[model samples]
Each structure stands twice: as structure tokens, then as C-alpha cells.
Target: MSLSAAITGMGVVICGPKEIPDATGNTLSAISMAAQEAGIDLREIDGLLINQNELIADDHLTLDLSRRGAFGTLKVLYELESKGTTMSVLLKQATEIVNAGEADNVVVVFADAAISPNAPSGAAFASMGGDTGYRGLERAGGMLGAVAAYALIAQHYFVERNADIDDLFAVAQAQRSWAVENPLAWIREPLTREKYDAAPLVAAPLRRLDCARPVSGAAAFIVSKPNSSNSLNPVYVRGMAQRHTMRRRHAPHSPWRPVGASEVFTDALKQARTTADAIDNLQIYDAFTIVPLVMMEELGVVGPGEAGSFIAAGNTRHGGSLPVNTGGGQISGFYLQGATPLIEAVTQLRGQGGNRQIADASTSMVVSVGGRLESVNALVMGVQQ
Candidate 1:
């Protein structure tokens, strides 16, 4: 018999605008909570997986984009005083380690503290300049950062699809509406189309609300053998898939090229032996307003260029056909890259989402993106029967 991976515990510490804790503090708190919920002592954890360590030092947010390379493993283990084996693995590999019997109880932690008031300016990061050698070219062309890059896509999308900027406004408004229900959300106020239009434009068609807030927080989850879980709801990892075929590809042609979201979602669903309709909830990555739109098209949830209309029709909100990012997502929720969506999916599947829980949500889908949509990964999780 093959082993299956299931999430038995989860912990999230979000730093709101008024109160922001250090990354190290948030990380420890998150780990302790997850371990407690998993019915295990902190010292009993045998495996550790860390995503990123965006430490909050002197009220400044510093992120080691390499996810701390090898040093991170040593630091986390030392700080936690754990005798467990430690390894840094991506989303898909974490589940594999547990399923392969290499680890019985694996705890994955991700801490980001980018919302501090004294955080470094956006120019301090090289990725903001563009990828490596292209930095100079992008800078010379007046492309400042991520917003500029996605703005280029937005421009092309509008021109090709005859879409309006109002679509972007709708996405921002929808996310805010969802955020209102989430206590951990940073921005919970209602947003109107008029308010969205009044907000300053960061990049041409992309308004300030269109971009996700880089807040400070940490999230951790326990992936263990299904039989080891004692929680009221054990969320099993039904399927997982990732595609990196376009990581090296750049813009202009990149946006028009086929995206990995399609293949990853299909492969994950097939591995789960289910179709998209079975997914009761979706926690799609929301780095920008356009990201989920593109994903919806590729995921077959909506036709190409019709995501705006689909969302406007309330297909993604609570009580809609497919509730998406019911816990505010990265846009209105904390931006921990893909970790935010992963945590949200687990919470919903566990039926512990409070006001954001989808009615009878037994199956959930989560997709994450990295490197400006260069790489995409998808995971299917279900409430274990």
C-alpha cells in the first residue's frame, strides 16, 4: 500500500498594519502552534521544510530570495532547538518526502516580514530590475519593477482582448470584499469601482489596488501520514504537479505563449482522479489583478479573455459557482508568495475558516506562481474520508 500525505496542523501569524512582529518571532509562534495542533511536541518533529526567511531586522524587511539556500536550514534548526533532520524543499517535494516514507511528520515553515514601516525601498532588490542580464535593458526602457512588467502584459491583454481597465478594478473590489470576512486580512474595508478608479495608477492600466501588499507574517503547516492525524478534518494531498517550461522565457512573446497553469492543473486533477467541477473551493495565487484572470482561462474555469465577465457575474465570490480565495488571497491578505494560498486551502479544507469557509467545502484546489508567472504549481487536497 502506498502512503498518503495529509495536513494535520496549521499555524499562521499575520502582522497587520498597526502591529507587525519580527519574522523570527512569527516563525516560532507559527511552528509551535502547528506542532501543538498536530498533537506532537515541538521536539518530536523529525523533518523540517522551510520556504523563505524574510527576516525583520531593526524594523527593516530583508528577504533572501534564494530561500536562505543551505544556511536557512541550519539557522531554523538551531533556533527551534530541534534534533530533527532539516531540508529545504519546494511545495511539491514536501508532500513527496512524507509520502515516500522518508519522513513521518514534516513541518514546513514560511516567514515573510515585508510590511514593516521601515522596510527597504523596492529598488534594493535586483529582481525588481528584471532577471539578471536583462536588468540594464529593462531599466533603460523605463521598466522599474514588477508592476511595470505586468503592466506590459496588461497593455497587451487589453489591446488583444478589447478588455477595459474596469476589469482590473473589479478584481480589486472583489478581493477587498472577500478580505472583509477574514480577520487576518490586512485590508478589510469595502471597495467600490469609483474608489478603485480614484486610486492612483501605479502602472498605466494597473492601479495601486491591482498589486498585492507585501505584508509581514509567517505560516506553517504539518504534512504527515494520514493515519497519524487526529484533527477533526484531515486534509489529504490528493494530487500535486508543477511545470517550469517557461521559466527562462521573457515578456512580449511570453504572455502569448502557453502557460504552465493549464498543464499543472490538468495533471493534478488527473492524478486525483477527479475533474475541476469537484473542487468546492479555489485558492489561486493573486500577485496582480491579471494573474487570476490568466489562470482562470488556462484552468478552464472560464473562457479566454472572459475572466473579467466571469468575476463580474460573481462566479468567484462566496456563494458563487467556485469560491476563489475566500480568505482574501495575497492581494488583500498577506503576501507570502504561494505560501498564503497553500495555507488558505488547508484552512478551508479543515472547515476552520470561520466566516470565509465555503459551504461543505470537502475538496479544494491551490495553485502558486513564481518568477513573474514563469513557473506554476498546482495541488489538490481533500477532506479525508
Candidate 2:
């Protein structure tokens, strides 16, 4: 018999550079408050998970903020590196630890500050690929490389499907409209089709608006076993899958080759015993607009190269047939290294998502990709036992 774990509480703190001088301190406070709100005492927390890039040391989980009294004394069982794909791994680990009786409750926290030293240069263009020194794709500048790759795929997709650029602009404009109502989002200014068209191209065929912004912030959540009478409802980790592909630089010289995303997503759906139609909402990691566009095909949300039409028909916006990225996604929402989508999944399942909450979102799918599209993790989460 497998033991079950559920999320009991959540907290978020998104501060611009001017709001908090110490990013770590703000993150600690956010996690602590979120735990308290969820009715868990700080002392009751048996494990801590931190995913901030700067705070992660070689082998130790530092607790400088705790010594300063932000959170009470507690055991820090495990600490993982902060990467785009760390959140899903942390969630799996936390659940396993709790169900295994190694811990009764676990607190996972993540925070980032734009002012932090070693912040990636050329924030507009970053790559999922770590430093490999590829000829055309620079390591630190891989973000741009990803955009370039996506633009290439998008252009091919459009040409193959005979879709117009106006369809893509409609998706951007709709997400921007949703961003206006989300106070936590970084880019809330309403986007116009004209503005999206006029924006300078970051990479060929990829406009500046198509790329995600680098915003500073933190978010935290508490997980525990379910009790019959708990105040907060539970969201179960129904199924999950992860896969890795050959590094892009090492792959065959065919740009038209199908990436490995479709297999991973399909396996996750099969493991969950659910179909694409069963998913009420989706929280795909959107480092670039094309990321979700690719996912739309890979996840079977639409047929090959049909995502532009799907978006142009207003199918991905709120109240659409398949609502997506309700928290404005990384393109507009706080970018905490891809953890934001996981946090949003929890919030949406708990019915705590304000303003952007889907009408009856009981099940959500979160897909995270990392390392030059080499690694992928997919999770099927739901508000069920």
C-alpha cells in the first residue's frame, strides 16, 4: 500500500528590487508566514527545501535567516540545487519523505532577487543549456539560443500549417490582458497586437515580447499527510514522469527532428490514467511563447502546428475550452526559476488563486523542461484523494 501526501498550505512573496534589501530574509519570512497560515507551527516542520540559486552552498543547507529569528529552530533534512526543474523534484522528495515517516511535515521555499550578484547577464536571452561553449549558442547566453531555436520551430510550424503571425500575436495579447489583473505579475501594461508586432526582435522571428522577463521574488508551500478534518483541502500528486534527451549540440544535424517532450508527456498522462481532455487547466513552463506552443502539440492539446489557431480562437485564455498559464506564466508572472508554475498549480487546486482562478479547476498538469531542452518533468496534480 502506498502512503499518500497532500499539500496543506502555501505562501508567496514577490518584491521588486526596491522592496527588499535582503532577498534571503524575505524568502524565509514568506515561507514561515505561509506555514503559519496553513496552521503548521514552525517547530513542527521537520524538513526544509530551498531552491534559491545564491543561497545554495556546496553541501550544506544554510539557515542564516533562522538564526536571525525569521523562522523558529527546525531540522533541515535536505537541500537541493535551484534549477528550472528543481521544484518538481523537491515536491516528489517531500512527498516521499512525509509518506515514509521520515518527516511529518515539509516546507519547500524558493526566492530570488534581481540584484543578487551573478545574476545572468543579458536577462532577455538565457539558455536552458548549461555552459557547453557551443559555437553558435553561448552558455551564459543560452536563453537567447532557446528563443532562437523556438523561433525556428515556430516559423516552420507556421509555414507548414499556413498559420498567420496574427494568430500568434493574439495569444500574446490575451496573456497580456490577463496580466493586467494580476498585481503580482511584472509586466501588467496591456499589450496590443501593434505593440507586439512593433517590438524589436530579440532573435530572428522571435519578438522581445515573446520572451519571458527576469523578475525577482520567492514562493513557499507546506506538505503533509491528509487528515479527515483538516481546514485546507488536499491536492494529490497523482502521477509524474521525467526524461532526458541528448544535448542539443550533440544531436543530429536535423532541426526538424521531434524533440523528446512528447514521450515524457504521454507517459505522465498514461501513468495518471487520464487523457488530455481530463486536464481542466495547464501550467506549462513558458520561458518562451514557443515553449507552450511546442507543448500544445506535444501534450496533444492540439494537432501538430495547430497551437496558433487554438490560441487565436481564444481557447487558451480564461473561460476558454482549455485555460492555460492563469498566473500570466513566466513571461509576465514572477519567474522563480520555473517554480512559479508548480506554486500556481497548488494555488489553483486549493481554490486560492485570486482573480485568475479557473471556474472548476480540479485537475492541473505542470510541465517543466530544463538544460537546453535535454531534461523534462511532467506532473499530473488534482484535488482528489
Candidate 2 TM-score versus the reference: 0.84
Candidate 1 regions exceeding 4 Å error are 1-3, 18-21, 53-91, 119-132, 226-229, 247-258
Q: Local error of candidate 1 at 384, Å?
A: 2.5
Give the per-residue lDDT digits (tens) of candidate 1, residues 259-312: 766788899999888888899988877878988877787778888789898888
Q: Which ten residues in a row have the lowest lDDT in candidate 2?
A: 54-63
Q: Which residue pairs collide in model 1, if any?
A: none
Flag regions of model 2 displaced more than 4 Å.
1-3, 52-76, 115-132, 135-164, 228-231, 248-258
TM-score for candidate 1: 0.85
| lDDT score for residue 299 of model 1 | 78
Query: Who wins the TM-score comparison?
Result: 1
